[model samples]
Target chain A: AQSVTQPDIHITVSEGASLELRCNYSYGATPYLFWYVQSPGQGLQLLLKYFSGDTLVQGIKGFEAEFKRSQSSFNLRKPSVHWSDAAEYFCAVRDNYGGSQGNLIFGKGTKLSVKP
Target chain B: EAGVTQFPSHSVIEKGQTVTLRCDPISGHDNLYWYRRVMGKEIKFLLHFVKESKQDESGMPNNRFLAERTGGTYSTLKVQPAELEDSGVYFCASSRIAGGETQYFGPGTRLLVL
Candidate 1:
């Protein structure tokens, strides 16, 4: 079974500080990875995805993630954190079966708190 | 373009009652998906529909849940004899058929079974 683990349940950071959220996955083979953000009272928004290519993938809202095959990790990072960036972040891996798309398996998510 | 939308932002019903949640995907999106998030748990997949066909329902919890995309445009998930453990936020998402891997999500329907 494929599963995702987001170690940080909650993270607090000062505004303008760099941010990094850890994510690890357990899968049989190379899988598609994604990052999503849920703002306060907002719908789930896609941040970025990695199917197969370069390790580093850039996403919307000035976010980026690096996929490390050896460590089975795809960590989300940002150079600076904003007060508005306080939200719930989820890490997920797509169930890829023979090049076809499958449902996404999400981690427990990490709630980010920005101290302004 | 309008994003996916779910009706009745919040619904509270007594246990053993029946409740139906509706989802209207983006116009022309062929892939519609259902997901649920129980309190303090990760959001999990319930099912997926491709043009009125059940593409994948492996994630559906049990027989009490039934999802149908009759016209392939909108979907309804009905839970009969709802249980208190079924309370959660149900989310609906949709994407285009061709090369549309990214699924857009709706605001979600928050259900509470008392």
Candidate 2:
């Protein structure tokens, strides 16, 4: 019954610009959050993950995300994006169902377009 | 280390035809998962396997789809009597542990059911 929502369908930003992709999730317990990126014809790559720890989590390629429990949001941010950052980004949540097997629920994804 | 690998990067078949997709997980991974994405939908979980046992298959849409992991190393997902609605990209991922673990994905198999 866990679900994730990504408000933006497409985001266009110029190179070197700061970027933020919004993500919200609904789950019963403390959630496991993750961010992934997928380039054309490539598999999904993990950007970052949030379990139980500091609110801010740093990821590869200079990307970061802050988990806000009050708002039920885990938004991805980058100080400066490069042209190669253009790709589809997905926000996912895993429910803590007290089981060893837990599947991830993903949002529809936000397609990032880095403009020159 | 090499990441997960899937066989037959793409497949095109007519409606009612049968298609099978294969996935070879990371060398030491024990947990493997299958997911699919329609043209514009989020990736949906199809099943999960721990070694050779199916831990969770609740996400499987129907009986027409079958997934098996033999010897706990690689997996295969077969869809019989494929429908147009089955056209999508099927992705396979693997993790070292069962729960709360990071999963690495393989390049998906694009299946088109005409």
Candidate 3:
């Protein structure tokens, strides 16, 4: 079955430190990968997505992700972490089987904590 | 423009009671979806609606859950005789088009059953 895996359950980083959150997916075809973040009381916000073309994808809030097909991974990275960036991050793969309208399969989220 | 919005940000009820969650998608969005996340699990899809029609409900756990999109507008998900296992956060999302569009999500409804 198609699934997304976010290996890290919780990660702590000092403010201004570099950050990386790992994600791996199991899918049969070329997958559409996405990163979403949910702050305390906010909804899930789109960080970045990778469908085709260049492997590096840039998203809002100074976040970027790289799609590595060979490794079946789409890990999110940021050059520097901000206190406001502390949030729960989720990795998801779009199931394109039942058309592009296919439902999204999400991974158990990774919660990030920033320490000043 | 307003993003998706869900009513009753939180709900708490005893087992065997009924609860209904509402979702109002962004104006002009043709597609809406429902997802749920139990305590320690990944958020899973529950269903999808294209306007007023139910396109797919394969992810719905059982018949105890009923979802409807009336007149292609706001939608509601009603759970009758709710069970403890039904306690979770329910999320609603919308997009103008399905295949290649970004889905905007709403603050989820956190449900707790005693």
CA lDDT of every candidate? 0.91, 0.94, 0.94
Question: Candidate 2 overall Cα lDDT vs. reference?
Answer: 0.94
**DockQ of candidate 1 against the true complex:** 0.58
Candidate 1 deviant stretches above 4 angstroms: A97-101, B98-100
C-alpha DockQ for predicted model 2 = 0.75
Relative to the unseen true structure, what is the C-alpha lDDT of residue B58 in candidate 2, on a scale of 0 to 100? Answer: 82
Clashing pairs in 3: none
lDDT of 3 by residue, A7-108 (tens): 999999999999999999998888988899999998999999998999999999999999998999999999999999999999999887754375799999
TM-score of the candidate numbered 2? 0.97
lDDT of 2 by residue, A1-116 (tens): 67899999999999999999999999867799999999998999999999998999999999999999999999999999999999999999975564437678899999999999
DockQ of each: 0.58, 0.75, 0.71
User: Ten consecutive residues with minimal summed lDDT in candidate 2 chain A?
Assistant: A94-103
TM-score (C-alpha) between model 3 and the true structure: 0.98
Model 2: lDDT of residue B39: 98
In model 2, the clashing pairs are none
Superposed model 2: Cα runs more than 4 Å off: A98-100
Query: TM-score, chain A, per candidate?
Result: 0.94, 0.95, 0.95
